[model samples]
Target: MGDAATPLADTRRWLERAVIGLNLCPFAKSVHVKGQVHYALSEAQDAQEVLEDFTRELEALVALPAPERDTTLLVIPRGMEDFLGFNDLVARAERIVRKRRLEGVIQVASFHPRFVFAGEAEDDVTNYSNRAPYPTLHLLREESMDRAVAAFPDAAAIYEVNMETLRRLGLEGWTALDVGPHA
Candidate 1:
């Protein structure tokens, strides 16, 4: 892959620029890449349901794109242990993607509530409801972030592309693309 540092920096820079250009708040979160399972436990019934829905959506995402399937997925769990469902979902996704011989990549991660931001503009965090925009931004654990940087230094740039693509399409941009059907 490209230099790890380059991609990581690119992702971070892209996110930073997007936040500014889109008038989005910082959201106080760090992004990273790694191979691990993350789960969140929540008491809210809605949170639990949304977590399941997120997993299904994630599975379908990885299955899309027929050729040159290089893609990264950011998975946000409902709560701790919610990753259990995520793991199952990933297995199913792997089967589908592999069966189609799609050239893509899938990376799963989770975000803490602290990393989420809500508001109409970038500076405000008022409207921040984790459920609306996305269930989670999925963070790479502290240790994993370090390793991900080591492995894919250029992840930052790649991540920028992801954020830019999202912005261009607008919120729920993936839905507009009909990557599958909206959850």
Candidate 2:
């Protein structure tokens, strides 16, 4: 989906063409339109450095008000290419959230190029729902999430609906979007 030189550009396109365009995350479009999404690129060369960067970004998000920064996408364009390693990093990130006593205040959601759900096959089209052009940590405010969920009816079915959408889109349609790791 993106090379080292243009992770932010690629990420923005994925947000526009896939996440928002396909309605993968129903709440994304509003914040995006408001310019409340923060995109940060980290050049950390290892897991520890990535965690440090994550901590900084986490603090940064909390330091700001919700109207100014509703969410953050910490894009790691280096040293986190392996999905398993990236998954481990995500665990560490959650620990940081707890360590800072922000468990309910903020939450971490992960996305990776090779994101595979539990029991799902590596090539399953469903995995694409969480797949992104790069390893990313999505930091969200719990209050904002709660409000959004409250406003959207049948929010519990978003995942099932996304699966149906992707199933209909198929591999060719996803390829047409050109937003996956291989794009």
**Candidate 2 residue runs with Cα over 4 Å from true position:** 1-5, 181-183
Error of 2 at 42 (Å): 0.7
Which portions of model 1 show Cα errors greater than 4 Å? Answer: 1-35, 44-139, 177-183
Q: What does candidate 1's lDDT look like per residue over 133-156, in tens digits?
A: 223333222333445456764655
The digit string of per-residue lDDT tens for model 2 on 52-75 reads 999999999999999999999999
TM-score of 1: 0.29
- Candidate 2 at residue 179, lDDT? 80
**Leading candidate by TM-score:** 2
User: How many backbone clashes are present in model 1?
Assistant: 36
lDDT minimum window of 10 residues, candidate 2: 1-10
